[model samples]
Target: MDENSIAGAAREFGGKVQGAAGTVAGNDETRAEGKRDEVGGATETRVGQASDTVRDVAGEAGDLADRAIDTGRDVLPEAGAAPRRGGDTLTQYAKEFPLAFAAMAGALGYLLAVAIRRRR
Candidate 1:
């Protein structure tokens, strides 16, 4: 446990002891003080737990990010090569069938325009 957690537990234990002593001695003020200490200790313990949880989550996020970066590095070259090959094939086809490609391109643009107009 962290310092805060340990301190909180100690405070809580002391409060309980004080409260019991006050009860035996018939001292209302000591009893109230003991109760207050118990609450403070509980708050401290919660704060410590929250801090530990945050640290754990942050470490996990960092690990996930590192893994993502490594995966992207490993896959990028092969993934990138496919797009270049596809572009080259399209270029060759366009060169061999210029008129047909132009017609198809114009039709595609017109269809896209119509689709956009309908959406609006």
Candidate 2:
């Protein structure tokens, strides 16, 4: 239990004791105060329980997000390996067609430069 829960329990026990003592002494005011304490203690205990429930829900959400990311990585490892395979294909094509590859590379560089300049 949290601090609020512990304090609430303590108050509840103390109230019971005070009420018993008040009853023995025939003190109406003391008995009334004891009853009020009992009600306050119950409210505090509910507050503590609510707080614990919220924390548990937030923790479960974080765990689910972590599991989703791990599953994505395991299911699509090829996404991470794609760049190496693409590079190998490009190298093979360039060896077979040097002049075509040079023209394509020059066009690609010009397009990249244009795009970068537009962004600024």
Candidate 3:
């Protein structure tokens, strides 16, 4: 995992230990601080996990784009061959990379909706 995840895990463990110690010593303030730390650490760890997920999705999208470009190049007309239709090309891509295609289509739809709303 990322640095935030590692640090958060460590902090969470420390907080648990501190909380237990505070409970044994009957210190309410220390116990509260430990609990707060535990919450903060858990939040940080979740943020780190989300960040990693975003990074992975972005990488996948990039790879998909690159592959699409390569496929387009390979499909280019040679020896007077007829050009492929846009719909067919898109259908091919959607079948080959369903998730990436869906993600891109959703993003495109969202952007279009936002643009249309802005015009109104």
TM-score of every candidate relative to the true structure: 0.62, 0.60, 0.63
Clash count list over all predictions = 0, 0, 0
How high is the CA lDDT of each candidate model?
0.88, 0.87, 0.87
Q: Per-residue alpha-carbon lDDT of model 1 for 1-120, expressed as tens digits?
A: 567888997898888888888888999999888888988898888888888888899999999999998898797857767889999998999999999999999999999999999999
Q: CA shift at 70, candidate 2, in angstroms? A: 1.2
Give the Å error, residue 73, model 1: 1.1
Candidate 1 accuracy as TM-score: 0.62
Q: For residues 98-117, what per-residue lDDT tens digits would candidate 3 score against the true structure?
A: 99999999999999999999
Model 1 spans with C-alpha error above 4 angstroms: 78-120
Q: Give the Cα error of residue 7 in candidate 1, in Å.
A: 0.7
Displacement of residue 106 (Cα, Å) in model 1 is: 32
Pairs in steric clash, model 1: none
Highest lDDT: which candidate?
Answer: 1
